[model samples]
Target: MKNIDVKSFGAVLLALTTSHCLAGEPADAGEGTVFRSLFGDTLERDYGITVSGLVDAGFSRNNNSSQRDRNSGQTNAPVAGLADENFELATMHLFIDKALKTNFVPRVTPLPGPAPSEASFGFTLEAAYGRNAQQARTYGWDMHLGINSPGDDNPDKARRDKQNFLAIPNFAGTAYLPYAGGFTVMAGVFGSGLGYEIPPNIRAARNPFASRSYAFMTESGAVSGVLLGKRLISNDSMLLGAELGVIQGQGNLRDNNDSKAVLGALRWRTPDMQTWIDYEFLVGDSQNDSTGDIQTPRGRLISRDGQFKQQHSLNGWHRFDQKWSIGGEMVYGHQEGDGKASTIDIVTGPGFDQAHWWGANMVLTYQQRKNLSLSVRAEHFDDPDGYVLFPSSTARGAFNAVTAGVRYDVNKYLTLRPELRYDWFDGQDSARPFGAGDARNQLTGTIEALVYF
Candidate 1:
């Protein structure tokens, strides 16, 4: 796993970003963003507060949209927040951070370098609204779907986002101690650091295509826990870091059950910061039943159905030249004691003791020009029992996605992204998951405008 990838999301992210191919945007900030220069960098360099955000709006056309499905409010469907057929506001995002100062010598890469000569404290806050907030919602908040419901049939579920589901993906504080290497401790609700793509954000640095991968679609978006990160080894050519945390079960605002879980991550990168890899995992009973009553996505609390699971992944990226790069990720998950979910109730008995799924994808990018880049991604996901993607369908086997996209920098504070993608399934025939369950495959075309401020 160490020999394969660069990376995305999770613990070490409070640190600066490594130079990835999708990296030159205002989000990277070092190349310079509106907010970074708004106060002439004084906000970060003097007051220590940095602000950044964007407004994302787009239109999508799906080849599978039918009159019947459109009337029912389901189209190419729930693959992210992009499950709609016309013009829509995807999200309005805001990020504010007071960076912690570490005692290590700063490198030339990664922008907005904080004062690294001393040990200090800092905090981060993020708020997002629009269709994308649906997935960012916690199990016991924002949303209301539960385990025993037939399915999510809210009617309003697919068309647009209401004002009620606003999400704060991160509200955490950290302290950096200039000790052996460096010790950073953080607490509060933070974004999940386990995948190659950031949670629920189509604008994530790893997802230049503006569309998510199957590997990132259904993982928990946030966890109310504490994370500890440390730089173990730092040198001119290479660096290593580690993190550990304890938290409430996945997507819970408060205690949904009596048990908590443990998660840890390890990362290694080069000083040049062009190549890196990450490995991380979470182990615990994120469900109800043994510890307490089960709480559904809708905040409905009921008796447990024996839900215990594990989610793990390994991902990374590498730059081969000024204009070429590649990145890849492998994801695996296991669930035990989970009852089959249905409209009526959670089913338990024989033939439902455990479920497992795994998937992988590779991304290749070419900097066609200084202001325009092209990317192609190929991925496959398998879930025989539909554990993670339960609400999508019950069909099993291998699911695949192919995507090609273009990123044109209209300017420093704006980008235009146009993408085309195809998704299909093989194996089970009992259910159809796309085009509102009427098609085995779907093709979608989308173009978005991201205006940074």
Candidate 2:
């Protein structure tokens, strides 16, 4: 008798499930001479696991003295908040995953329906590092512990932590169950079901801009939760999901507050797969787990817990023709309390007001050639209460931005994108958000390269 390892066993099981055994063998070939002859080397072969990754790096130059703080060399610029004119590693991600089988048999048939499909189970582990990782990392621990500083005037080198160096953004397992038609269950940190623009890693992720919108920045990110989804129609065009999780904004494994969040989403796609839409709603606490010491509306920063937050978003994209496509997103988000009162701690009592913001953006893309594409985006966000944007400033107004870019695929593994963007601060009486406090608008030019396996 011989002992078998997990990888070798996995390969054997896959071959058996796929009915890919050697040909010219008896149906009941327990004495399998041909199988042994053809796959004698299979016992040493790697299983179905796959390895893929992406490298996103770029140089960005700003026009308004770069708006970078002279003392800290940090800018409040939008997406690629690089130091004025410098090259930066925007983001890098490595993924190890396996495709799960898609057929599952029901334990017990409760109703008459289509035949059960085979069951599949798979997992994904992904790690990311770079500036984008800094932006997407969980906010509370990273910010409070000084692990990351997005717009800090003075950064502490010693306190800079591993959250920005090597962050495990996603580790999820997926399983399929043949219940009513079928159900897919995912556990662990998963990308937000909202947003038309996903984290840019590969071409298939569908993020056309190097700079992101204000809505995308504030609405959602990788969430630590359990998600269950099912197809509601036979065409496989409609999907509905329910998510229960630790709350939004924070991506760490632990929940910050006693309050939990519930999220619901609906996704629809056309039969041709050219048009798709997704809507998601979430309500939960946005505060951290601070038990003591919070800020108030008063000039002094004190100790007080914060209230719950609510957010909803709709994102969709449509292909008008072979060469043209359009995408749009709308987001509405609100948090309870003013700047000082919005503590990271959980608050059960109501002593604050609601700060809200709503924003929408439209994206147009044209495939000029097989390897060349162009995209333009226009977005507007209104923060009348100065809630979601500049919390400390007395500014209350809207922000608008326009962006145009082109993507040129040099090859299957490499792409180059160059873009120009302009942002305007509308109806603000105080400090400007983009520049060095003296300007209301800023202009920037950026180019990035994405290399993937």
Candidate 3:
């Protein structure tokens, strides 16, 4: 008999527990409740804390695979986020949330009335056995650009080399203020405010798609920072926020440089809350070194130093009645002085100091029934410096893809999505991104199941 790996086993157990907790069913009293009731002692255990989680798994096949055993390693999808072709566990997320009592005003009150404000604390512990988990682990605490570690030099690859499960991406504390018609302050590691797509399990309703767009595929993941937000207009029609952080992205255990990143955002919505728009901008330094698996984009291992990175993005969505809606995103990002060995020649070229990339995506969804919805997405991405794409080869170019899928609610606790996607490459060299220089276009089919508890 083969001995089982203990860590993998533990991850599986955690996943199951999370799924059971978030499955959309009523919480059971269970033996603990019975014991407490029998003793007539309610430990005040259920106070203000909430626990929830999800288990996401998928079965996918990539026609571009090089062999049955090895991946093609040339697709646009980031490493671990999506495999070339396989049945995999995408993510298992467990969330714990607690709201601080708002009525506990101090004996010496500064305000005339009760402090009707509350504070909240929440954290998500994520685990994965597949490629996506391998790509999303943040290393160190708030590390910056241009530092190197000995053993696993490639930050992104290091994840592939290390554990098969476990990631803690969201650890945050939020405070609500009653001043100026109420506002919020939050600090910790959280998702970036720049992108339309986010890591799964953050929202009550999961996005109806299996894969993500190029913008999400290549953009920053999370940030270690502090943020402030407040609604400005009546009916919550307008909101503003700002973020100050250690750097632009995640994965580093410590700050590698002295500089930091700043971000600002403005959001507007209709009085009916049917249509909304957000504009966000971020400026900061991005590390050229490999920090870890969590911060890298598309599994590209960056090895330069003191690279300046900036981003501008706009995102919005509109609801046309309750059955149909549309959303879109546009983003442009640039980086310079962040190249490695292969980019030296290019960076030294005349009038070339930076690499630029831009992309746009649109998503349309239709609700077919109470438990069913359909969605389609199309996007185009451009990369001129080959910075975020083909980090090894000089594959500066563009990529285009489209996806169509359906979301079916099997039950309150289970959801399934089946999708089809196609991608085409327009690199300088025959689009030789996949292995053996033979992959320029790809067709993939995938089905994903999500269990919430």
Highest-scoring model, TM-score = 1
Rank candidates, TM-score, best first. 1, 2, 3
lDDT of 3 by residue, 1-453 (tens): 012354674466455445435554344422122233354443336554455556676667766665632333224243223453454556666665554333211100011224455444433333333335444545564222122232124544433332234455556675666676555565676656566776763323325688777677565555667766655554343323333344434443345444567766666666565776777777777643443432333223344445677787888888998799998889898776533453232233323356778999899999999789999988887876666543433456887888999998665556778999887778875556543456777777888777665
Worst 10 residues of 2 by lDDT: 103-112
lDDT of 2 by residue, 253-290 (tens): 45555556766676666656577677777776655445
Ranking by lDDT: 1, 2, 3
The clash count of every prediction, one per candidate, is 9, 12, 14
For model 3 the local lDDT of residue 362 reads: 93
Model 3 bad stretches (over 4 Å): 1-46, 69-81, 99-130, 142-163, 201-206, 235-249, 288-306, 338-352, 390-394, 435-437
RMSD of each: 9.1, 11.4, 7.4
**Stretches > 4 Å off in candidate 1:** 1-45, 71-74, 103-117, 139-164, 200-204, 290-294, 297-306, 338-351
Q: After superposition, how far is residue 45 of candidate 1 from its true place, in Å?
A: 5.0
lDDT (Cα atoms) of all candidates against the true structure = 0.66, 0.59, 0.56
